[model samples]
Target chain A: MRSYLSRTTAIIGMGLLWLAALIEIYPIILVVFSAVKSKPELAVNPFGFPKEITFQFFATAYDTMHYFRSVSNTVLIACVSVVLSAAMTSMAAYAIVRRKNRFHSFLYMLFLAGMIIPFQMTMIPLYKMMVDLGLYNSYHGIMMIYLALTAPFSVFLLVGFIKSVPRELEEAALIDGCGIFQTFFRIVLPLLKPALTTLCVLNLFSVWNDFLMPVLFLPDDKKMTITVQISKFQGMYSNDWSLLFAGICMIVLPMVVIYLLAQRFIINGITAGAIKG
Target chain B: MQTNLRQKWKINGIWLLFVLPALLFYLIFLLLPTLSATYYSLTDWDGVTSTFIGLDNFRAMFQDRLILASFRNTLQYTVSITIVQNGLGLLAALLLVRAFRGVNALRTMFFMPHIFSGLVMGYVWGFILEPNIGALNNVLEFLHLDALKMSWLGDPSVARWMIVFVSSWQNLGFSMVIYIAGLQGVPRDLYEYSDVEGASRWRKFASITFPLIAPSFTINMILCLIGNLKLFDQIYSLTGGGPGFATESIASTIYKVGFYNGIEWGYGSALSIVLFLCILLLSVTMVTLLRRREVEM
Candidate 1:
């Protein structure tokens, strides 16, 4: 009886895992396979291996979406914004945490309040601000907006991580003749690598995959990011399943590749991000 | 005493120097926008013109059918995503607790979708659930289950559910990862004690595992609530608030009303302020309620 019970439980576990694996990958598999199949094959063999595979769709999508420019625009925007948020927020969080004053709590509430305020509330004014700044369709304008949007969360996350760091080390660094900026850059920043990485990767994903800001700010196709580019493609190719399949794949594949390569860091980064903060 | 006061001022001055850049960005990008919402929401501001319109915008907002439905849909999306995402996450954490072959690969596959923007993910699902040539129906036909092969995005009810499903699928890995971390932190001794007492697996989890991971529960719940309430990208990419106002959330509606063609600047402002309030109220209440539960235990 005991042997039978153990076997039953083990089988059930495997079944559950299989169901989950399907749930996780079903749509994605359809997407991957759809990209490779001809339009006729997609309708006939949607769940099966592609009857004939071709890279034609990818080539088509690459040109249609202006893939190179969009990727560059996305990378440029994500990189600059993340770097700015990291440098600016980490320094601010460090100052706030180290002060040990009422101002820290006041700043905390301010950030927490900022967190609850949706972008929609201020999006109009922000768009107008971008227009007035002569950056409505430029990369720098979008980059500045992203930096502003993500800063509060980054500051909040780092503040939590910063509190857990003992001040004794920083004091010792100060005693060893390191200035405050030097202590922060050389000592505290090193200790914050894990949290910093978490913040950067998370920020990178948000900025890279962002649609609303890019659609609104970078209205010009030349300035458009990949997400917005494909969205526009979807509109043009709404009826053309074959071309749309390839377009979606072109947009999704790079991120999927990046995630696969950096799976360990990505998972570890977010885990630390959540558990500590 | 005078020297102490001077020293305090000097310390503040030094710290403020370090934080100035961040504060400047926050003042312009975040704080300014938040404060400006009040003025815009109450006025007849349409980019080129501005006039104080009092509560007229708010009054018009309540009578707007699409706005009402959008707010209702937003609430439903939040509640459903929170419960389902957390429930599935806890289950994944439980299953993955015991190390097995391909565990790492499974976790990676699960998390891979989340890295994509929700808009792209929506488009991916849009093709899969596209009625005639869609993968979902294609499979149903092959299985001879043609009755189940409904146009997934056609019906109002089914369209919203598909949005929820796609959102949950994309976000499951995030919730699961957090829960697994929470599970790892639950002390092994408690489980050992339960085992010694011959308690059932479910009972052990109920009595110990669940309570210990209460903090993760709170964090995950708050994150989902805030994120879903502010949802825009998925609805935009998937349904476009369509088949005639079926799956519209306020986030999507705001963009449509404000920027789609002729901008209803003041009306959109009022719509978003309402969204902001809903998020603030719901999140604060949830955190307090969940924290109370944690203390009660």
Candidate 2:
């Protein structure tokens, strides 16, 4: 009797899970379907399978989006910003963890406070400062801003993770005549892989999907990031479903591919970041 | 003593070296800009020049009906997303905690929306919900349901809710994933004991699962509250603050006032500060209140 009741519950549970999954995935599937359908086909059969697939929309979207340039530009900014931000913040987090002084504790609090200051609050002054400093529309300039924006959260996450790391390893490295830098780079950093991976992944998503910063600071077509370009493309082609869908496919596909490739790490990374915070 | 003091100075100096890069970036980009923004909020700066207007910008903010309307909209948007996303997320997590076939694929699908930018999601959903040629309306028409085919994003009454629904739809998976992690963290012994005692499912959950996942509750609620309070991208792409400012978020309004409308930098800065305070107060209150609940549980 018990086994039968439990089995029924399990089946019911699985049914609900699949239903939720279908709801989550259906819109995405429709977008992909519409991307390949011809204009007439899209109008007639919006949700069904396309009778004939076409790559012409993809081709047009590619040129109009400046697919390669904007994508590479986005990748450049995301990668450099993620790498540099992680390096700097991790080092700072390490210092705060190891030193354990009043100043370090105060610094830690300051960084945590930074998390409360919304981007909107800083938008006007930051833009003015960028223009005044001649850093507007430049890759490095934007990268610097991304680093600052990410610093607070990165420091918060890293500090939590780093405290769990045993001090004995670093002490052993120090006693072996290794300097602080060497001990840090060789011993402490390699030990921070899980945390660093989590931070890097989160930073990548923020920098890549970020719309406002690039729109405000890098307005030039030559300097546009993928999100900005997609927004622009979206505005211009709002009426053309076929073209707009193709453009969206371009913007979404790369992230999808990356997510699929790194599903385990990405999931665990996000889970860890959320749980620790 | 002199030698020991010198050694302490050397150690602190090296630590300073390690901290300098992040500090410089924070100071120049974050802290300095924040301080300057506070100053600008007090003045009537038009991006080019400024006059010290004292509390004029802030006083003007209270008189501006547009600001008040957007604030109300933002609060509604945040409250709706918080409840819907977390409610459905907790439900999904309860089902997903049990082992089953193809569960990994299901998890992947649920988290897939996190990959798409909000801009792209808004546009895609915008296409789906277009009243005239949208897939949704077409489906409704096919099913002989003409009454359900009004302008989805055009009606002021429906558009705000649609924005809330779309925002939650994009992130429901995220909240699920977080809750799943939280649920998994609950030890199995409690559930085992409950099962042996023949406790009702709701009894077991309320007594065990709910209390155990208090941290996740706090995390999901505060994160959603903070993120939705600063809603921008989705609002920008979906409604552009709308059929008649029906969905203008404070963040979008700040953009319009600061840059797009006429560069009302001073007033924009004041609005920004207000947003910061709203987020700060709410998040802090939630953290303390929720943490107390966790302790009580």
Candidate 3:
């Protein structure tokens, strides 16, 4: 009798989770379905499979949103900015971690404090600065903004990781007649892989999906990132739900694919960053 | 001693070289703007020219009805989102603790939303909640629950709730992941110990599991609180603070006033400063309260 009751409870638990799972993916499923369905089909069979699978919606979305150009721009911008931000911040973190001095400690605290100051506080002046520098629509300008915006957390994360690294590794590098840059490029960076990977994945998701910097700085359609392009598309094509679905799917596909491919790394990296904080 | 001093100066220079780029970026992009926000808040700056106005912007904020409504709505959002995300997350984490077949797939699906930006998720939900031929209302009609179907974003009262719901849906997976980590930190032996002694599941959870995961609770709450307080991307895409400022948050209002509207940059800075103060106060208070509890535990 007890076994029967326990079995029933287990079944109920499984059933509840299944319902939650369905709810979680239901919107996503509808979205993917909308990507292929025509406007008439979408209106008629909002939740059902499309009667005719039209590839034209995706093509129209691609041309309208400039998906190819915007995607490559997003990728390049994220990659370049992440590389610069990671390099600079990791170097700063290495110095702060290894060189124990009052100045370095103050510097560490400064970067730490930067994390809490809301970006809204900086947005206005940053916009003006970008315009004044003739960098409003430039890729490098956006990259610089990203580097600045992301530095604090990247520094904090790297500082924590670098502190855990043994001092002897650096001392040995020095003894081997390695330059400071070489030491960092060779020994420290390779060692900082896990933390760097965490920062990289986090930054990729953020920078690619970044809207404010892109919206304010990269106003030109030719220079816009995927997120900015989609927002612009949404604003103009508000009534075109079918096209919106296609554009959104295009925007979401890379992120979803990356997440699926690197789920474990992404999860572990994020969890580590969280608990460490 | 002279040689040692020279070596120290030389080593410090090299170290400073490594630190220069990050220092320059932070100073230029972050520190300068933050300091200027305070300065700009005092002046009637329009990005081109400025005149010292001396707290007029601040005074104006207290009289602004939109600001007040946004504050109320944002506070409501922060409180509700924090509770629901953490509660639902904890429930999911607890249930999923014992891995079964397809647990990994379910976990992946749940967390898929977390991978995308809030902008995308908000846009996605914006369609799902559409009044006519939207998936949500369609589901309601199909189930013969037509009464529950309302204009999700059209109604003022309903819009804020819908924003809250979308924000929660987007972030719940994150909270769940955090809680799962917390749960895993709780040793398996405690559950085994309770099992041998035949403690009720609820009792075991309350006595052992809850206390063990208190740190996770603190982390999740603090994160959710800060994120919701600075809410913008989702609101920007989802509602644009509309159906007549129903779902407007202070963050969104700042954007509307400063960026989109392009007239009230000084006033925007003042409001942004206020929002920062709120976040700082809440975070500091939460840390203090939670830390005190943690020590007692």
Candidate 4:
């Protein structure tokens, strides 16, 4: 009787998990279906398969939303910010971990403290400063802000990883007449590839999908990121579910592709960060 | 030789060169602005004129009903969503802990939503729950439960709840991932021992499972609290804090007060300061409590 009860419970548990998974995935499926369906078809049968799948909405959304321009902008911003952030954060982490000085500890704590302070506090004044510096509505301005905001977390994560790198490796490099910079670039950075990829993926998703910063700082239409661009599409055609879903599908497809391609690294990075920190 | 000192300086120079760009950006963009915000919060500046009215902005904040309301709304939203999301996450994590087929795919699907922006999710749900010709109401009408169809985003009473539900759905995967990590750290021997003792499932879960996952709960709760307190994108996209400001969060309130509604910069800075302190205090308190609990375990 106990065994039978346990088996039944296991089946019930699995059923619940299946239901949760379906709920999670249904929105993506719904958007795709709605994107292809005709307006009348959407209204008549919201959940049913499209009578005839069409690329009209995709083509319209692509042009109306400036999808390619926004995609390029997102790519440029994410790539630039990731390269700058990774270089600086890894160096700072190397210094702090290898030196182990009082000053290094203090700086490390300063970055950790940055993690706790919410962005709302800094946003208003940051905007005012950007405006004064003529950096407002500029891509470089937003890129600069993204680098600053992302650095602390990247540094925090890299510090932990850097600490794990064997001291003997660096000592060997030094013994072979490699200077600090050479040792760091030729040895330490190569060893830190996993953590660096993790940081890049994390920052890529954040910078690409960020809404508030772009909304606040880059209010101009010409300077909009993809998220802001999609928001504009929604605001303009609030009732056009077909076009809106098409816009959303366009914005999400790249992220979905990236996530699927690097699913293992993303999952491992998240799991590692959660478990350790 | 004097050249050795120059060599040391050159090494420091290289390090400084590597660090200068990031440091300069962070200092100018992040540190300097934060300091200016603190100064502005003390004055009566409205983004144009610079009038120093020391603490009057803060004093005025104490009497501002909108600020108070935003605080209450934020607290309520944060508490409700954090509890519900983490509860659902823990339940999902527990079920998926044991060996199961297709668990990996299920985990992947469940976590996929986190990759999308809150703005996108907000727009998707906004369409799904539109008052007229919406998918939700259409389905409800088709099911013959016509009375169940209410203005989901328009009703003040239900608007906040809808935001809560959407935020929870977006964040459920994040907490689930954390709890899965925590669950894996728990030992198999403890479960086997509990089974051998013929302890009921509820008893085993109560005694063994809950405490083991306390660290995950604490971290998830802290993250949820901070994230919800600063939540603006989802709320902005969905309701724009409409229906009589029923859904105005602290972050949205700050944004409106600062930028949209004629730049009440001083008052907004004050509000932002309040939010910062609130998050800081709550995070410190949570960390202390959780660290102690971790020690006890």
Candidate 5:
């Protein structure tokens, strides 16, 4: 009787999870199916598999959104911002953690406090500052904003991860006549791989999908990111569900593919930051 | 003594150089803007020129009924999203944490929504929930449950809840992932011991599981609160805070008032300050309250 009951419980648990998973995936499936269907077909078979797949809508959306240019723009911005922020913030985090002093501790706390300051609070002044400095509408300008905005949280996470790393290796590196920069870059940075990966993934998510910043700062059509471009495409082609879904799939599919390919690292990065930070 | 002092100074300088790059970005982009926001909130700065009005924006904010309604809507949206999202997340986490076949695949499917931005999620849901040509209504008709069909994002009453629902759907995975980590941290021995003692599932959860995941609970709650309070893109895409301001969040209100509509920079700054204060106050209170529960457990 005991064994039977436990087996039943396990079956029931698995059943519930399957139900939830289907519900979670159904909308996304519908999106993909609808993207391949014509408008009239979508209206008739809104939630079913398409009778035939078509790439015509995808072609139109690709042309309309300048899909290649926008995707590349987003990739360039996200990559540069993540690399710059990770390198700089990791160094700052190491300094803040290792340099045991009142000032450094105070600096650490200041970064922690920075997390609570929302973008809405800084956006107006930051916009004016960017414009005045002739940094608006440029890739490097937005990259700098992303770098600054991500620093505090990056430092916060890296600081937590760095404290767990043993100091003996660094001490040994120093005694071997390696300068502080060399010891940090060669010894400490390697140990910080997991945390840095986490930071880069999370930062990439925000910078890539960011709509408001590019809308405000990078207003030129020549420099629009995919997310910003998609929103604009929607405005012009509001009634075309097929076209809109194709555009959305363009924005979402790359991230989904990356996540599927590296899910273990991505999942671990997210959970690790949650627990440690 | 002189040599020792010089060495300490030299070490400090090296550390300072390490921090200098990040510090410059943070100072110029974040800290300076924040200081200016506070200053601009007190004045009637219309982007170009400003005069110190000394609390006039705050005074005007109280009288603005739109601000008042948006505040009420913001609070309603935040509270509902927090409870519903975390509740579903914890439940999902509990079930998924069990050793089942294809568990990793199920976990991946559940977390897939989080990879999409709020804007994309909003657009996807918006298409599905449209009144006339929407997939949802069409499905209801096909199933012959026409009574269940309603204007999901068209009606004002349902629009706010739809925003809340969409936000929760996108974010529940995050909370679930965190809770799963928390549940994993609880020692397996405790559950095995309880099983030997013949404790009911509820008894086991209430006594052991709940207490152990309190930290995750706290973090998830605070995150949901902050994220929902500042909801913009989702609402922007879903309803545009429309059907007559029925779903305007504090962040959207700031965007429209400060940036979009006539560029009320001073008032927008003031609104943002309020938002920051709300997040600060609520999260601090939540942390304190939730931390006490963790400690007590």
Candidate 6:
């Protein structure tokens, strides 16, 4: 009787998880279904499959939203910001971990302090500065801001990973007459690949999906990133459910593809960061 | 040797070089803006003007009804969503801890919502909750439950709760994942020993499982509090603080006051300073409290 009860409980647990999964995935499926339906059909059959699938909504959303331009802008910003942030963070981490000076700990703590302050606190003044600097609608301005905002956590993560590298490896390279920069580039960095990949994926997702920063700082139509572009599309096409879903599908597809491709690393990176914190 | 001294200097200089780029970016972008926000909070400079009136911005903030409304709304959303999300997450974790076939796949599916962007999820759910042609209302109508088909995102009373529900749905997966990790870390031997001693399942869970996952509870609570406190993207895309200022949060209010409405720069800065202090103090207090509990355990 005990064994039977345990089995039944297990079955019920599995049922609950399945229900949760269905709820989690329902929106994505609904968005796709709505994206293909005509306007009248979407209103008529909100939950059912479309009787006829047409590509017109996709065409309209694409044209009105300027989907290609927004995609390029998002890709450019995320890529450039990730590269700059990774390089800067890793280099700084290398210095702090290897040198182990009094000032190093102080600086590390300063970066960690940045993590506690919410970004909302910085938005107002940052917007004012951007306008004053004549970078209110420029790609470089947004990219630079992202680089700065992402640097602290990237630095924190890299510092923890870099500290784990054996000192003997660096010492051996130094004994062989390799310079400090040479040691970092050739010997130390190669061993830090796992951490590097993790940071790259994490930073990529954040920079790509970020809406608030781009909305405030890059509000100009031509300079908008994907998230801001989608917001604009929603604002304009608020009554047109099909078109809105198409826009959502366009914005979500790339991230979904990327996540599927690097699921394991992404999972590891998130769990590692959480458990360590 | 003299050569060794020169080598040491070069290494130190190179180390400084390595730190320069990140430091330069942080100083110019983050530190400068944060400090300027503090300085601007003391003034009455509109965003476009050069004039300053010291401390008037903050003095005005205390008198503004909209600011007070936003503070209340933000606190309401944060506290409710944090409690519900964490509660549901813990329940889900408890259920998932018992081994079953296809459990790993179930875990992945449960976590999938967390991986999606909050903006996308908000928009998707916005469609789902629309009163006229939303799937939710249609389902309710088909079920012959007309009384249950109230305006989900349109009514002031219901809108805040709807936002809470969406926020919980988006975040519960993350909390569940954390709890699962915590649950797995608890040794199985404790459960077995309790079973041998004829402890009921409830007693074993209360005694063994609860204390062990105290650290997880602390971490999850702190993260949920901070994340919900700074909520903007989801609220922005979903409601835009609509139905007559019923759902305006601190971040939304700051954005409106600063950029959208009329660029009240000093006022916005004052609000930002208040938010920063609230987050800072809350986080410190929470960490201290949680750490103290961990020690007691």
Model 6 quality (TM-score) = 0.96
Q: After superposition, how far is residue B67 of candidate 4 from its true place, in Å?
A: 1.6
lDDT of 4: 0.86
| Structural similarity of chain A in candidate 2, as TM-score | 0.95
> For residues B33-93, could you state the per-residue lDDT of candidate 2 as single tens digits?
8888899999999988899999998898898999999999999999999999999889878
Q: Order the candidate numbers by lDDT, best to worst.
A: 2, 5, 3, 4, 6, 1
Question: How big is the positional error of residue A168 in model 4, measured in Å on the Cα after superposition?
Answer: 1.1
Chain B alone, candidate 2, TM-score of: 0.97
* Chain A accuracy as TM-score for every candidate: 0.94, 0.95, 0.95, 0.96, 0.95, 0.95
> Compared with the true structure, what per-residue lDDT tens digits does model 5 show for residues B1-297?
999999989987898999999999999999999999999999898988899999999999999999998999899899999999999999999988877678889889889898788888889899889988888898899999999999897788799999988888888888999999999999999999999999999999999999998888888888889888888999999999888888888899998987778888999999989999999999899989998988998
In every candidate, what fraction of the native interface contacts is reproduced? 0.69, 0.73, 0.68, 0.65, 0.70, 0.65
Q: Candidate 4 lDDT, tens digit per residue, B1-297?
A: 799999988877776665576667777777778888899988877877978889898888778888788888999898999899999888878777666689888888888889999989888888778878777888898899999999999998699999999898887888888898888998989989988999998998888988898888788888888888898888998899988788999999998998888788888888888998999998999889997997897
lDDT of model number 6: 0.85
lDDT of each: 0.85, 0.89, 0.86, 0.86, 0.89, 0.85
TM-score of every model versus the real structure: 0.96, 0.97, 0.97, 0.96, 0.97, 0.96
Quote the lDDT for B94 in model 6: 87
Instruction: Name the better of 3 and 6 by DockQ.
Output: 3
Q: Backbone collision count in every prediction?
A: 0, 0, 0, 0, 0, 1
Which candidate model has the greater DockQ, 1 or 2?
2
Which docking category, incorrect, acceptable, medium or high, applies to candidate 4? medium
Model 6 chain B: ten consecutive residues of lowest lDDT: B43-52
Which regions of candidate 2 are displaced past 4 Å? A1-13
The global Cα lDDT (0 to 1) of model 5 is 0.89
Largest lDDT belongs to which candidate? Answer: 2
Candidate 5 residue runs with Cα over 4 Å from true position: A1-13, B1-3
Which model, 2 or 4, shows the larger lDDT? 2
- Residue pairs with clashing backbones, model 2: none
- In candidate 2, position B51 carries an lDDT of 94
Per-prediction interface RMSD? 1.5, 1.1, 1.3, 1.5, 1.1, 1.4
Q: All predictions: root-mean-square deviation over Cα?
A: 1.8, 1.6, 1.6, 1.8, 1.6, 1.9
Estimate, for each residue in A87-151, the C-alpha lDDT of model 1 and write its tens digit. 99999999888887798778767765777789888888788888988989998888888878887
